[model samples]
Target chain A: MVHADSSRFAAGMSTKEVYAQVLEQARTLFDGQRNWVCNFSNTAALLWHAYHSLPAPSNAVNWSGFYFTNPSNPRQLILGPFQGQVACQSIAYGRGVCGKAADTKVTQLVEDVEKFPGHIACDGASKSEIVVPIVKDGKVVAIIDIDCAELNGFTSEDQAALEELAQLLAESCDF
Target chain B: MVHADSSRFAAGMSTKEVYAQVLEQARTLFDGQRNWVCNFSNTAALLWHAYHSLPAPSNAVNWSGFYFTNPSNPRQLILGPFQGQVACQSIAYGRGVCGKAADTKVTQLVEDVEKFPGHIACDGASKSEIVVPIVKDGKVVAIIDIDCAELNGFTSEDQAALEELAQLLAESCDF
Candidate 1:
């Protein structure tokens, strides 16, 4: 059980810190899993699990599930492992935040729920969200997504750190 | 035209050098093009153009022409841009070198002609070639291909440089 102070993993931490923390935590959490690299599915599962176990965690953030799509249906991302209430299992590319992130491969960190165009309300209370593209061999393979129940929850540091972690996953994992 | 010392862009150059020179020269060659991204289609075009322009370039390198497929049709890489007499436009995703690279985002650098499995002989003289994936988001969207008329023509540096160039394109362009 490797634990870092919650303050160190705050929204506005530096890019280096955010990435280092995710990788460091992931390594600690999944070190025993027998795989060269864990896919987005596994990462999401771990994040959900961590969110649930953390003390004084908010209810608005649903840390319950993840999803992926096969090459035959590249346009959609299907649900994978998750922890809170059940979520919409499928999202089309270009539809919601998930879709837009998949289409552009650029991170989208939205501070307000109402401002986002085509915001998919899996949890209506989710006020802020951060979505990062998982790139492998120069193309987007999947995405790392975090949603906050509170408004203005994410920062540039969060975005940078998640992007680095995404890059590391891309290099090490197959999917 | 921005003519590089052809020797600087030699067959044995590192992957980084290959990427830098290709981009540098390409920028000069196609100065005003809006999208400078490389794909299987455009990469094939680059090889075709290079084969025709460079003096006494190896005849054994048979990048004379190539094709790629849209995801809708997995049967082949449809007839794309090329510069040679005979070319195969469509190839199954599991069939030839191009298909294999598409299947796995890993770079395939072939040194000897006869040793390669599924060597699609568009031209029998092609003794060596290198294929690097052009990734966007996390998927392999295209491949940067280099073929030499001579045996064992590509090196690790060439692979690394081209991979770096591929990364740069993925970061800089929206393809």
Candidate 2:
């Protein structure tokens, strides 16, 4: 089992209902996923689809998951876990939160889309975000990102939880 | 020019005429060798040599430096930088200031080594000590160590200066 919670499993739920339900489930799931959790647009898409289709859903919503036009020549997010539709695999530094995190070596957590200075709207529905830097040897190697549809969805508990997760990832992956 | 001042240069000079003259000349030459500062051992060695050659040289001297042998392997401070011949490279966490700094991720400046519980004595002549951790990604990666012959050899100013230098190295080096 890849660690799923029964509490999030709801009966007689619509896709939107499931989306709402699973997200709540995912909060705990993500927290338990090795103390760090990140998702690309694809992962985001998969999450969206999974949320929409509680038990068994269609792939329609899945297709529209993580999609971002590359601002840099070679845009990719490298190898990590993701969901939803196919994502632009590569991204450049200073382009996306993924890129900017690489460039600045700083963790970025955006609570609202409108307030984000350079908001890259991969999915207009995503309104909140948390990006934790995975650093090694005094350098930022990668980031663990989580996107949410609700505003102010992430809290300090989320931040602390994710930070610990990031540390675990850095230690395990040798980042 | 790689940021060297005469006063700072003099801080690294020794009282011995031969060593003082050599350090003075080395300061000028060191400008071009900025990129050469690598590894905890190398920086430790440089600081050790510099401290030993200070203007007001101590009569009784003791010195040692520490390195992280296991990146994830906790509980040990492998010997790193030093000036005097006596050294204990490998020390367990909770044993000495070097190990304790790594354990606590806090800088430790002790006026007298004797007062510190579990102080590991690589050199019996050492009466005072300072230890600063090199932190990255919110974790302690290494430490800058200083040992002196005189009691209360390290002041707050020395702590601050060494801390600044340690941070510089922490930000500059890869590991």
Q: For each candidate, report its DockQ versus the true two-chain complex.
A: 0.01, 0.01
Question: What tens digits encode model 2's per-residue C-alpha lDDT throughout A1-175?
Answer: 2122222234566655544443444444333222211222112333434434443222222212222222232233342333321123345567666567666767666667678766665456566776676665665655666666667655575456556645544554422
Q: Report the error of model 1 at residue A165, Å.
A: 1.2
Error of 1 at B107 (Å): 45
Q: Can you write out model 1's per-residue Cα lDDT over A42-114, one digit (the tens) per residue?
A: 3543354344333322224543223444344777765433333324446788878877888887888888867
For model 1 the local lDDT of residue A56 reads 28
Q: Please estimate how well model 2 matches the true structure, expressed as its whole-model Cα lDDT.
A: 0.50
lDDT of each: 0.53, 0.50
Write model 2 residue lDDT over B1-175, tens digit each, in one string.
Answer: 2111221234433344433443343344333223211123334334544555464433233443445534445565544333333244256776778888888888899989999999877556678888888777787766767778789887776667667666665555554
